[model samples]
Target: MTDKSEYKDSFRCGYVAVLGRPNVGKSTLMNHILGQKVSITSRKPQTTRHRVLGIYTDDDAQILFVDTPGIHRKEARSINRYMNRAASSSMADVDVLLFVVDGTQWTDDDELVLEKLSHAKGKKVLFVNKVDKLADKEEVLPHIAHITEQCDFDAVFPGSALRGHNLDELTKTLKQWLPEGDLFYPEDYITDRSERFMAAELIREKLMRSLGEEIPYSSTVEIEQFKFNDKGILTISGLILVERSGQKAIIIGKGGQRLKQIGRDARIEMEELFDSKVFLELWVKVKDGWADDERALKSLGYDDYR
Candidate 1:
């Protein structure tokens, strides 16, 4: 941990909330900026269901990047409401609000995020992500122009989060907006989340990637056991909770092949992230209406922001 007094007088440190609708690459942008995988991401919408902090420290500034859940109009379930609350809450008490949008297209969800951001106070930055997907380079300017027309932004940059394009310039510009202050987190700390929470997220990411559209959203991961054994290997046991038995059956697959593959994939990533020998065990359990039940959602670690 780096002490606040140890930093120079000119050092700048503050929170930057990364706000956007689901599947807009908010997590991907934060991960690339920190040069590490602190936030889990997938093609599925609302992959990030919590307000994850990714701390970045450099010689000049320390940026506490708050990677939040994508704000959408759908508040269909308890989990959805929880995610929206988590994201909306992050808007307060941040030094900057980095609004990310898919440059290829825009939707009502983007407008919803912008409307929510309108009430928040901060240095607002518009990030037009996925510009690389655009067939013509000229299309970028018009798209950026259209978005900026709706709301006044302090700064706007068009870049590709996946390819790490224009992010360096964006970071430099963001540093200018932050006031000089002490580091919020230690210099070496990359995230505020615990290793146990990260393990559960990794398992959930595998579930999202492996399963079909509906199951991933209905499922959640709970870390039952996490500890270093006497053999110097980290052993983890995770329970996958779903709303229905049919969803559990689909995840378990024929002879449990699907579950085994998901666990294997998660374990491999855990080994790389934890930098240790990992022994991961996974089990599927049906918890009826867990996603909609407020008590169940809270027990599953969904109410931290609330």
Candidate 2:
């Protein structure tokens, strides 16, 4: 797959940044494009905190998809500021920008995305996602029409990432705009993120789903230990950080039932993701105001990976 002969003389390759407000299916779109889950998704906003690259290669084209944290106007905490910076930085030095939005609803945040796009000088493409949830199918065209008035985008695509709708058409359009260049990664590689990073994300995904509203925004997961034992079974020790003892009690639940369930579910996902047996352990620790501290964020592995 690494052989240059596998590629054609006119092979196209370029970076495409997937930018939008939070919870607008940006991660879902990238997962569908790559045919695997490189970014975590949940009902909760701000699920993606760092930038991840999903690479797709074929006979004539290779698309390096940049899945960034969602952009918003509010930068209340250091983490929010970091997310905004990550999203904005992804827009620079890209062949094109795929600005995604929820077709079912519109808000000032959508306008905020447009404002960001207004300053970006590269080719812009719009994707109105989640059209399958609309009560009336006819609302899609009107929504696209309204957004077209705001910015003269090079192209507009309306599709549903959830249902795999119109994605083939979307891929065709993206391939046409790429520049002729060598592949940045080998054809067999789907993502640039390490296995440890993905393990932490998978654990966080389970916690977010299990704890639901009781979990505070300050909560984060860090893998303290990850190694294979003599028998070749993976062993993992994770630290679940919270802001207060009360949050810890809530996560622990009565007789530690809740934490056990969270660990059980997370271990199952880890085994599936790694394709090996895993022995997992979890502990809750209080880290007061870690989200607001920039140094703490860096220690928690929130910094950019390149």
The best candidate in terms of lDDT: 1
Q: Model 2, residue 132: what's the lDDT?
A: 81
- Full-model lDDT for every candidate: 0.92, 0.88
Per-residue lDDT over 4-28 for candidate 2, one digit per residue giving the tens place of the 0 to 100 score: 6677888999999999999899999
Q: Give each prediction's root-mean-square deviation over alpha carbons.
A: 1.1, 1.5
Query: For model 2, what is the error of residue 90's alpha carbon versus the real structure, in angstroms, after optimal superposition?
Result: 0.5
What is candidate 1's CA lDDT for residue 193? 97
TM-score of 1: 0.97
Off by over 4 Å in 1: 4-7
**What lDDT would candidate 2 get against the real structure?**
0.88
Q: Tell me each candidate's TM-score.
A: 0.97, 0.96
* Residue 296 in candidate 2, Cα distance off native in Å: 0.1
Q: List the candidate 2 regions with Cα displacement exceeding 4 Å.
A: 214-216
